[model samples]
Target: MGIGSWFGFGDKSARASEPQPEPAHTVPTSQDLLDAVDRVEQQAKDGKAPGMVQSRLGRVARTVRDTVPRLDTLGSGSPQAYNVMATATNYLPDAIGGYLRLPRQWADSRPVDRGKTPLMILIDQLDLLGATMDKVFDAVCRADAEALVVHGRFLEEKFGAAAGGGDLIIGSTPVPPMPATDPSGPSPLTPPPGRTA
Candidate 1:
């Protein structure tokens, strides 16, 4: 055997045969995403994030909550779905956590990048996440809305009438029309001889 082999470094086949490590980043489950969001909220509250920061965090959290249920609609392979997962599990928590790690007075008051404080940077990140989540939510909901429209069109075509404008039918019976009103009579709405209403 070669010197390298003696040192356990020369056999490519052996290296290939060894078990590999799991991926560093696996897709999170829905519950995992929600737990992350809850952690972020608790951190924000405990860390005393500013009102502005809290507001932004709340927006991102709400959007994440709204989007999680519709992840399937976004398709497991879609980037939008990935964004939802990452925003909850990584982007949002990281942004808030990083800011919380800093001295509050300094993080809020001192500029760290291009004249922006850590607070400002966190806000920007939160805003971006919020907007992305909003878009994903809209995209998911749009699919259902479009289906409703398409179904309505199909229904209209099958019934041969506008949705609410034609004679009503239930199973095999047509609903009767209301009797005509007499033009010369006192209005039906006028109480018999106005006793106090």
Candidate 2:
């Protein structure tokens, strides 16, 4: 007998009657992937010589260009895109860390808004932002902040309707805590060598 049936907890006959839970589904938004990529690129750029970081960033960009088509198709019909996108996302942190020379934690702690060039971009379909691609392009051109411009074409091609209304939310820097102090008493030095009983 099955464990459920052996304990007299459930009817053996009802075992087949119970419905199985459905697997959870997650969609990878274009903004999320782009932001991840940009973050990695930023770290690489910051840490390495401009030439080295540029070369690596170029490679990553090429990889994105190559993979995005496949991702879009998969996004339309497969549950595997989540895993694929996640795998792609993972590479950025490593690339960033390698280029930066510092630990990933250090790079992550730096402010994303302080760049002369935009630190990250969110690419998606025009409809996602409820704006025209031209308008976005224009905004990027006019914006005072250094901006990473996410390509709308890529978003439209890969994510279809799902890429609509996407925005990149930059991850926050984590603040390190101050060391704890003893609340009970003054320094032991104050008592000085066992004076008296």
Candidate 3:
């Protein structure tokens, strides 16, 4: 709808004339991510990492640290292995950093405040990272290099959207089905005949 549009120039043309803002998060290379993990690990141990962030970073760091010995099993030549490693080290911890950057008032109130806040957004980012970690771990266990690579791309999609300032929702949890309990004394240890265990 700008004057450029009437002249047949697309938004891209108009955008090219404007200075772009620096990105909030820098996409990390493998080495950069590894170094960050090391720093974050030390930070966590030093008790300087913020409360919620500490555990998440520690978990990702530990998972990747344990996987280091088995990188060969995943294959050094496997891009997915590297992708998984980088994403875990990079994006996961970055969310923690994002939370730390928020003002204490905003960060503290976010937990009780009934609105979208920076802390809430960072939490959503962490949730995405945790899910990504699950996929990476599963792929590594299965020695599925391809899946790891794809998972890296998936992380980029989710994290990229967040970095791009898109809405991220943690949404409600769905209740899982539970088995009915019997008041009668212990049922047979084994399922009755003709029933699947």
Candidate 4:
């Protein structure tokens, strides 16, 4: 074995024996893609929170639907494109679920979000997912192999293995809790005193 081969970088025979992880590539069919998109749409409708969250989710859903056609487009139909789309889809449902879990009072208050409301944060996350879908769509539309590679690297850096499952922890920022409240009562969007315009 050469010096390179000595450090677990063995001969072809040894390398071949080692099990490799399946590539993140996904060869999703049109039906599969469409079905996944439908699920995301339903999730958007069902899980949408009140106020800004609803609007953001609506935009994200529309963007996802728009990106679906790119799957059947000439260049963007590659497995890599599907991989990115799939990852984005995976994140959507979980994100909506996270929003549903947070009380409106906490999610709406700006101080809890460090000057940004939870709705703003949620919108940013949806925007990121939509942007990725747009990139994948554009790459496919143009059949630009180089752009495909660039998109792939961005996914790799941004998500690592998480993109495969589309489960990035976007709501990691803490939202302050409200005072005691009735579970059935509506949570009010109240700005702290003296801060009100």
Candidate 5:
């Protein structure tokens, strides 16, 4: 006010020189993915989609729910990760919303795509999403399964045979071998010197 407002010279220059705040780069969380799934499910329910559509939608949602916690296994910025996010946040919702926008009777009866009606098309889309989600879930699980296999192999290599000639080996410790017994010797189960059974 003292210098810039009076002269009108410093105000514009100072404002231009100041750094602007960057837009927030929002990273979706697992809960966000679950909430998206919930929204899509509720939409399908409220929209009164056919039984088949509801079933397929449930399949995709279930798989996405299972996979959300393991998305890190798919790696950040990877295609699988992106697909999971996109399916939850956009593709699934868009497909349902598009169908829902149409009047129910026309959507169910009219064949907009060749011989298939909108209902059929929506079912197909849901099936595709379901399969894709299944694959993504499998990929996430497979990462942990592979790690387990690798660890088993490592243990086998490091510890040699776990049971070699009936001798057990646990980690680095070797189980003590059974004492040798003479065929003619007194029964090993006999009571010791001072006691009799």
Candidate 6:
């Protein structure tokens, strides 16, 4: 007897499977985050008790004062900026890889080989930007003739211990050459003039 017959199976297609329902919880939107930022900025501006009591509050207030105007002018709605923001948010690995290429491209485009120029690794989102930014920063520091200019918050958060007074200012270090790989299966070797292998 077949296994199905032994199990007392009668109808081949009697019952129908029900489709699973998606979860009802809504994820926080970008506008929600922006609204939160606005609230924080307002609190800072109004000197609200608990939030305004911190020692660094004044510094944060000043930064907000400086950044708001620029942020308004830049307007997160621009296509180019939105594209970059989306790339950084959704596909950080590709973003970092592409970002690293900028300095190399700039260096290559220069007329003379003046060694590596100073590199400014601007990490916009401290919380959202992944650890790969750190790796890229390290790579830039290790490359020959490259100086790093990192954002203050990222420097403090990531390399705080190594960050002496404030900010991480890494000098250039020599990068070891990468071993070359043969593109084709095997390198073609020309036989010696008279002898054949």
TM-score of each: 0.73, 0.31, 0.45, 0.46, 0.72, 0.18
| Clash tally for model 4 | 1
Q: Each model's C-alpha lDDT?
A: 0.87, 0.48, 0.64, 0.64, 0.89, 0.38
Choose the strongest candidate by TM-score: 1
- Summarize candidate 5's per-residue lDDT along 99-118 as a digit string, tens digits: 99999999999999889999
**lDDT accuracy of residue 142 in candidate 2:** 41
What are the runs in model 3 whose C-alpha is more than 4 Å off?
Answer: 1-35, 44-50, 76-79, 110-114, 144-197
lDDT of 5: 0.89
Cα lDDT tens digits, model 2, 138-161, are: 333444232222455555568775
Per residue, candidate 1 scores C-alpha lDDT tens digits across 59-148 of 989988988988887776899888888888878888988999999999989998999999999989888888888888999899778879
The alpha-carbon root-mean-square deviation between model 1 and the true structure, to one decimal in Å, is 5.4
* TM-score, prediction 3: 0.45
Tell me the tens digit of each residue's lDDT in model 4 across 1-197: 67767687648787777799898966566666567656755665675566466666566566656666655554554664555566545677677767667876777675546688766777788778767766766666566576687898897888674333333454895554445677676546656567663
TM-score of candidate 4 to 2 decimals = 0.46
Once superposed on the true structure, which residue ranges of model 6 sit more than 4 Å away at CA?
1-23, 44-47, 50-197
Indicate the residue-level lDDT of 15 in model 1. Answer: 72
Residue-wise lDDT of candidate 6 within 21-140, one digit each (tens)? 878955334454344444544543453322212223333333333333333233446443343233333433332333344554553344432342212232322222323333333333
Query: What is candidate 2's CA lDDT for residue 122?
Result: 17
Candidate 4 weakest lDDT stretch, 10 residues: 161-170
Better of 3 and 4 by TM-score: 4
**Judged by lDDT against the true structure, how good is candidate 6?**
0.38
lDDT tens per residue, model 3, 76-184: 6676576566655656556666566667576756654457766666656666666666666677777756768788789988766325344345567545445566868
Worst ten in a row by lDDT for model 2? 121-130
Query: Against the true structure, candidate 2 has what lDDT?
Result: 0.48
lDDT of 3 at 42: 72
Those runs of model 5 whose alpha carbons end farther than 4 Å from true positions after fitting are 1-22, 164-197
